[model samples]
Target: MLFAGIDVGSTTSKCVLLSDGEVAGAALVDMGIGTAGPERAYSEALAAAGAAPEDVACCVATGYGRASWKGADLTISELTAHGLGNRFLFPEARTVIDIGGQDAKVIELDAGGRMANFVMNDKCAAGTGRFLEVMAGVLRVPIGELEALAAQAEKAAPISSTCTVFAESEVISQLAAGTPVPDVVAGICVSVASRVAALAKRAGVKEQVCMSGGVARNGGVRRALERALGVPIVWSAQAQLAGALGAALHAWHKSEGQRGEVKYG
Candidate 1:
């Protein structure tokens, strides 16, 4: 049976297609059409799987834009999906930290891989990808190049940015002060990482911290996070697709119901 998961996030939307609990295909895209963006991602992913929408046994929509998804069998919140995806990827993970485009979430997992407690920063974009994008713009470089420069920084400067607008001003001031581009950019990473760490602390972070979402792909942020949290992080090839993966898991359970197979939460 084929199942699908669609994640429409603040910055990007992703969809995953699964066949018999294995990934058949996935599609990623920037949110263009507001709520319909998730549905588009779902359609693209389904096409990548060489399957039509009707062929999917179930399609579970997730993320901020989940409500916009049309033709989904059901919809799940990012909190549940992130927990589900993290547990599915790393059964040992006790904590999950996800930094998306507009928010950062810390999820504490129960022994059964359920969400025990969680905290999120949805009101601010500081700990998310938008902050990085703004800083990268100030540095006059593409977002992709900021990571390399951040990695080479000799010393990260201090950036006090509790908000994106304030952070932009600080970035400009640093540039005018001749603070070294790498140092400034790396400092931005550090600031964001600190915010994430603080959020994780509030949620009672546990060992085996698993970082997911697209921001985890950032080398500077990852390194700073490893330093601030003082623990090793668990990441995988599917790190960026946690929500979509969780949706796929939900689809699997739905398909299992059709087969009358017992499944665990």
Candidate 2:
């Protein structure tokens, strides 16, 4: 039987299909929450798996917007979903860091891969993907180009503000003072890393750290995070889909139990 997981995040929606303990299909949509993204992503994932929605034996939902989707068999928190998903991808991982469109989180995992402790920054957008978006706008560059530009920086300009508004002003001033765009971009990455590293430190850093969510795809942020936390960060191409994968795994487990199938660890 097929199991489905749908994550309705703040800025994106994702769907994952699991068949007999293996991922059969996955889809990610750029829109989320109040939009039609969840359904669209679910449909695309079904298409990818060559199956109809009725084929799914169970469905789980997660992320900040999970409550908005009434079709799920169950709902899980983002922290739990991320912890499970990252552990599934990297069994050796002891810590998980997720930087999404609106927030940042650091989760510490126990020996058995359960969530031990976690710290989240949802009160501000300063260190989140939204911050990067604002900076990209100020630099007149696309969000995708920020990492490549930062790679060419001779030195990172200082951005001392911890507030997004003030940081944007600082970035503008730096550019007005003739600071290289690359240097400014590098500074922005460092600033974001600094904010998130503080949270990681509070949660207590551990070896074998895995980064998930969309910002994990930013090479500049990844390098800066590594520097700040004094550890190498591990990630995968499917990092952005971790939440949905975890939800799908949960669905699989629930479905198996209902079918009276022997569970696999």
TM-score of each: 0.93, 0.96
**Tens digits of per-residue lDDT for model 2, 1-265:** 7888999999999999988777888999999899999999999999999999889989999999999998899999988899888888888899999999899999999988789999998599999999999999999999999999999999999986389999999998998999999999999999999999999999999989999999999999999999998999999889999999889888887777532221222
Q: Distance (Å) between predicted and true CA of 15, model 1?
A: 0.6
lDDT of 2: 0.90
How much does each candidate deviate from the true structure in C-alpha RMSD? 3.2, 2.9
Q: Least lDDT summed over 10 consecutive residues: which range in candidate 2?
A: 256-265
For candidate 1, lDDT tens digit of each residue in 103-213? 889999988777889998868878898889888888889898878999889999899758888888988998999998999989999999998998888888789899999
What's model 1's TM-score? 0.93
Candidate 2 off by > 4 Å: 257-265
Identify the leading candidate in terms of TM-score: 2
Give the clash count for model 1.
0
Error of 1 at 42 (Å): 2.1
